[model samples]
Target chain A: MLKSNPGLALCILIAIGAICFALFSGDPYYVQVVIWVFANAALAVTLRFVLLIGELNIATAAFFGIGAYTTAVASTILGWPFFISLLAAPVIAGVISSLFGWITLRTKGPYFLLISFAFTEIVRLIYTKTEALGGNSGMIGMFPPMELDAYFPAIAISILAAILFGLYAAERSNLGRVFKAIKNNEDIPRSVGLNVIGLKILCLVIASTAVGLVGGVHAYTNSVIAPADFTYFVAVLALAYVKIGGEGHIVGPIIGATILTLAGQFLHSFGPYENIFYGAIIIGALLLVPGGIVGLGVRFKAGTLMGRAGR
Target chain B: MELQVQLLMNTLQIGSVYVLFALGLTLIFGVMKIVNFAHGTFFTAAALVVTSVMMWSVDTIGMPIWFSYLIAFVMALLVVCVIGFVVYFFGFKYVLKDLNGSFILSIGLLLLLNGTYLILYGGVPRSIPAVIPGNITILGASLTIQRLVLMIVAAIITLGLYILVHRTKLGLSLRAVAEDQEAAMLQGIPYRRVALYGFLIGATLAACAGALMATVTPVTTVIGDDFLVKAFIIIIIGGLGSVLGAILGGLLIALIESFGGYYFDPSTATLAMFVLVVILLIVRPQGILGHAEK
Candidate 1:
């Protein structure tokens, strides 16, 4: 499969290299940055996964938070074993997202968008209000087992990279086609006896589960989890990454996340100007490069081909 | 009886501003078919302008408090209107009827404008001294005179909007376009122009709410953002693009917030609102008065 798809091969190679670097790199800071890029990529990709059904799912942030919180609770409170605590993130996120999607997928467009946004905020509010979750200050002390400490970065990056590949594989499957069909017009899919709503829920569950796993990894990586980290703004930035990287392909968001996450490191010291910088980039991308970087490349390639044809 | 009356008063006071804010949001949704997340920025701009103008007029220029407030109110409206016009032309116009595009655009504007406000105003919250001092008893419930005026003015503006929407030529155009853009255009309505007017009207309503709110609450760069989540809940409950729905939704949410906050705690009130929204989605996804989504 990798031989047939050079792009897929390149992605795998990059993931392998990233894992190797995490394992061998001397600087913990750089390793931490690598974990963040993959985590963010997971977020942006999962967000775009829902976009397959043509709905903007802001609840991506909520589910990510849920995953983190679940792992946090399982590890810190219940004292669950490492793997069990980590695996609980996806299970809990999937269950909640399925329920969330089942109830909300009935309303599409603006209603769905607004409701998901409200859900994200409400979930964050719940965290801040609940004392066990550590409230506004959030929870800390989420450490991987001491034996696994040296390998945690590699572990985190590998799981996050797996999420990216797992989603890409799903997107290329027949189920992905059904999602696109539903987006084009649900009525047609329904006419064919497809359970449109169930498929949407499935789509959401798949994406949420992936994000939840990332959240679990995030819990271990950051060693601290807070309510503020999971604001709807998280989804907004993911959407920005999707837009700037070009949502036309799965790779777009990954690329966008990498660039922005790196840029963010430098932008950290700029104070209020950081937000202004991101805001400007989003607006500029929307107005100027509606398709993002990937889209621009496609247009450029098409233009060159046409020029050759004309010649 | 007094406690009930007091809660009712609280509901009306909170609901009045909510109505103004949600009306703009729903109106924009109706006319442009885009959610303006930056709607709060308009509110913040107006409130910021109000505080600055009030300080200048009352403190520096030595104007009377009431007179200075009037100046501040009008100036706030003007400033927001200009900001509204600039954004409408530069950004919102291109994204008309595009939901995700508009959402992203508004968010970007939200960040940019909010950042600018932060740099200009700093992080401190500012409150102007009351223009109208003293209190009055209504049904054995004591109320501040200033709050009473806010409710009255908000009511007047809301009523004026109702009349303008239902009784005027422009209102006909707005409703017609919102119902069906193609048909409205076929009937000779200038869709783009009407959308601009609707957007401006919505921004002005938010400005009015912000200006009025500045009188009661401390004004901060982020004051408008506090109202954003609640306003979304209000519109969702009221039904998107329905003026009446926004009004009813605003009041309903305020009632819940006031009574629930009073009976339980603030966080419980918020959670209760979310629970209510979930139940609403289950029972009537379109909202209390919202038209069924096509």
Candidate 2:
């Protein structure tokens, strides 16, 4: 498989390099940034995963929050072991997302979009209202065990990279083809005696579970999690990443996430102007480069090949 | 009895603004087939304009409060219309009937406009003096005269929209296009123009709500955003693109908020609304007045 797909091989090599850097680097700041890139790429990939079924799932943010909160509650409140607490994130997020998808998947297109948006907001409201979850101030103290302290960043990056690879693998499988068919027309898939809604729920569960794991890693990485952190805006940014990266393939979102996350570091000092910059970027990409950066690259390569043939 | 009357009055007051806001949202959705996530920005623009215009007219020019407010209200509507026209031409026109594209475009507009509002107006919440002061008692329920006027104006605007939609030639074209764009175009109706009109009318309704809301509450850069979530819920429950549904949904949500908030806490009331939405989705996913999806 690695011999056939050089792209996958390169990705694995990069992941190993990132993990090695995290393990060996003395500077924590750069390691944190690398972790953020992996985490955001996972988010963008998972978001695109659900788009396979033609629904804009804003609840991606909600499930991420759920994962974080589950880990937080398990570790801080229940005093579970580190690995178990982290494992609980995806489990809880997956279960809740299945239920959420069952109720919501019935509504397609704009209805699904609006309902998911509402779900994200309401989930955040629930977090704020529940005092045991730390309310508006949010929860803190999600540290890994001392022995794992230095290795936590490496571990987080590895898991996040694994999520990216796992999702990419799923996208290339038969299940992914079914999801594409559903997006093209659900009735066709249903006519085949397939459970259309069931597949949608599964798709949501897979993406949500991935994001949930990211959220769990995030909780430990940041050592704090807040209700404000999981707003519908999170999904919007993920969508931006998907758009900018070019959603034609899995690599687009990763590239988009890496560029934006790093740009975000520089934009931090600009105050409210940061939002304007992102807004401009989103609109510009939509109008000028609807295909995103990857799309542009594809067009360029195609043009050069055509020119050589013409000559 | 008095407490019930007070609650009823509160419901009507809140419901009126919601009806106007949701009507615009539904109307735009009906015509363009795109959700305008930046609809709240129209509301924000109007409220911000009202605040500035009121302050300039009253504080600087020393105009009388009521007259100054009338000018501010008109100015607010005008400014929102202009903004709507610019956005419709520059952005929304291209994304017509494209839901995801339009959603992203509107969000970009939301971030850009909101950021500009923050820079221009600062983060402080500003409130104007009540244009009409004093209180009145009706059925043993006391309400300020200003709030009473706000409700009256909102009701008048809502009724005017109802008449325009039902009785006018323009309204006929709007309904025609919304019902079936291709069929309407076959009938020689200009789909794009009608869509522009529908979008402007929707923005104006939001402007009306924002202008009225500024009279009662502090106008912040983000005041309009507070209504966005609830307005979405109202539109969803009422059914997308249904004017009457928006009206009914708005009133129904306000009724729930008023009574539920009174009975339980405000957060519980919000949770109750979400629960109600889930139940509604299970029963009638198309909404109470919405047509079944194709």
- List per-candidate RMSD values in Å: 2.0, 2.2
How well is each residue in A94-213 modelled by candidate 2, as lDDT tens digits? Answer: 999999998989898889999999999999999999999999999999999999998999999999999999999899999999999999999999998999999999999999999999
lDDT of 1 at A2: 68
Error of 2 at B33 (Å): 1.0
In CAPRI terms, model 1 is classed as high
What would the C-alpha RMSD of candidate 1 be, to one decimal place? 2.0
Candidate 1's residue-wise lDDT over A1-311, tens digit each? 76799988999999999999999999999999998899999999999999999999999999999999999999999999999999999999999999999899989999999999999999999999999899999999999999999999999999999999999989999999999999999999999999999999999999999999999999989899999999999999999999999999999999999999999999999999999999999999998788888987897977853353310
